[model samples]
Target: MSVVLDISRLEPRQVLFAPSPLSELAEMLHVLSAPDHHPGLRAWATATATGLSSGLADRLAEADFLWHATRADILLPARPAATLAEELDALDERDDETFVASALEISCMAQYHRGVPQPLISAKDAQEARERAAIRGPRQAAFADRLLTDPRGVRAWLRRLFQDCEREFFADAWHDARTRLYADARHKTELLRRKGLAPALTAISPALQLDDQQQRLVIDKLVDGAGTTSDLGLTCIPTAFGRPHLVTMITPGWRPVIQYPITTPDLPRPMTVNLLQARLEALAHPVRMRMCRALARGSHTTGELAAAHGLTAPEASRHIARLKKAGLITTQRRGRYVGYQLDLNTVARLGSDFLDSLLR
Candidate 1:
């Protein structure tokens, strides 16, 4: 059978009337694959192909094909604002880590797919990252230096990189998709209240529902917003892109935390060791680890993370939740959205300690 036949003639309810970026990519791929097919699709695919490496284009083609056959669900809209607020209140009443874990999972996936670099910070990047660290306090400079010199230390420091990406991607896609679905601001808000992320309006919807804990977490974030502290202890505001906002917070000891005003859309800066530990623990699931490696560059939310990593949102969420529970990262709120960032300090320290033990 032809590859197109692989896609069912009866469109799945999940995809009916919904714009599928993946499908669009696939149609383009099919045209590219068959020279005799529609000339328009072929021309579009060829044009897009010019910007990508052959390997990446082939991977995207495979992804497009897989998406067509799969019945994966998408993120759901937020519940009614009142109910969401109540749910969040209930969540705060309980100290269980489940909701936090879920948030973390989303964050980890986001980071793996979208967060920024904490590599063996080049002398240039290192010097600047360290200078920022000094303003936070005295010990931070040494901490930054240790992270640069040690292999395990650097890896640990950079682990949250993935979570950051996950967070940003989720927010951007959700907002854009939701806005397209409901053009009116008041209606969009109302819809967000009903569904959780963005309300689904289509007759055939693939929107996933949020549990009570998830609902509560979203409520708390929506009302409070999220922000991070720079290495110098100055609060940095989150830019629209998210990851670039937290890039300034690369200090030691003093890591970023989720706070109101939602200044920066990136994750908190935890210890390098914490990040490393989370990554190592998360590595037990190779797929999650692969996702993490990808996010080291910037933030991506659940959907983008899944698309990039070639996994479903739920599957990716599971791995990300595990990373969050390990205290390797944190999440932030952007409008009715969430984003992730690395806990650089904790991860850096953990990495340095591990190296010390190994050398001993």
Candidate 2:
């Protein structure tokens, strides 16, 4: 199963590369909702989740559907907007029917993420929304009922939720990430011009491939669908928060957008000394050093690490967790037990990273 986008009619003029602040915010909200999927962002997401106001946390639970249907039309600007405020302003200017229709449409798609075999709504109407609301469980059902009964109010409520996310954390996060996002977009745009469309498109992610003969951009996905980029030209949005997955909005009536991951890992953040210290501390302990020596040879189960070190399972597990968090090791689950392996590259980089931190 895959998504095939016909690029036969796609023109260079139709292709756009820009950073979508609202889209990034939506993806960040998604990171908060499902931190496990984003291991690199787990720490920040956990802290952000802990610090959110009670009211905002409750709203996030209700709005959990947004993360799953992130490529929904309403969440994305019609054209590239320079700032988050600009995008939010454009969203505010939309008509009532557009808001209602988008909400209903996105709600139906959210059902699919919940593992529903078919969409809850066949027709995008108030009655269909009401019917879906009845089975959406308590939290989402309330959000759905509000959308059908008071669309305008729902719009305002959602805007506030988005605003709260920006004011609280995403503003700072976007500030830190925008430079990297913009650079990645520029690089991809240049790739399109210099290397041609196929290489440029596939460079966005490993899951994407271009079939030159078929004039199709084949995306490896679980769901199956095919569409042409005739009416809606392709817009490529590079997102820092959207790592490890690619999202597309090729559904009929939505502006086509591909929210792809940035090719490189996140730029090294500040607090270099603290980071180096944490890594050093992870290895400074005698038990951890021996564990690393053993793991350096090959992967070992938690039971093996414990037995070899003459320690209890809990003690070995604690050391393993600390080392894993410090980026010194990687873990793979094997049936009932978890296997741990030393991350040689990260360990080797520790010396250089420490030296660079001190001099630069």
- Best-fitting candidate, scored by lDDT: 2
The true-versus-predicted C-alpha distance at residue 82 of model 1, in Å, is 67
**How would you encode candidate 2's per-residue C-alpha lDDT over 1-360 as one tens digit per residue?**
678888888877678889999989988988888887788999999899898989899888986875754445676654769888788788888777666666656554443333222222334445556566556677777777776667778888888888888889888999999999999989989988997777788887867777858489888776776767886788988888887667877656556788887865553322233456788898889899888888877899989999999999999999999998888888888888788998876776666554333233
Residues 289-311, candidate 1: write the lDDT tens digits: 56555544456577777788888
Q: Which has the greatest TM-score?
A: 2
TM-score of each: 0.22, 0.68
lDDT of 1 at 158: 27
Candidate 2, which segments miss by more than 4 Å at Cα? 68-71, 109-124, 265-360
Worst 10 residues of 1 by lDDT: 1-10
Predict model 2's lDDT versus the native.
0.76
Q: In candidate 2, which residue pairs clash?
A: none
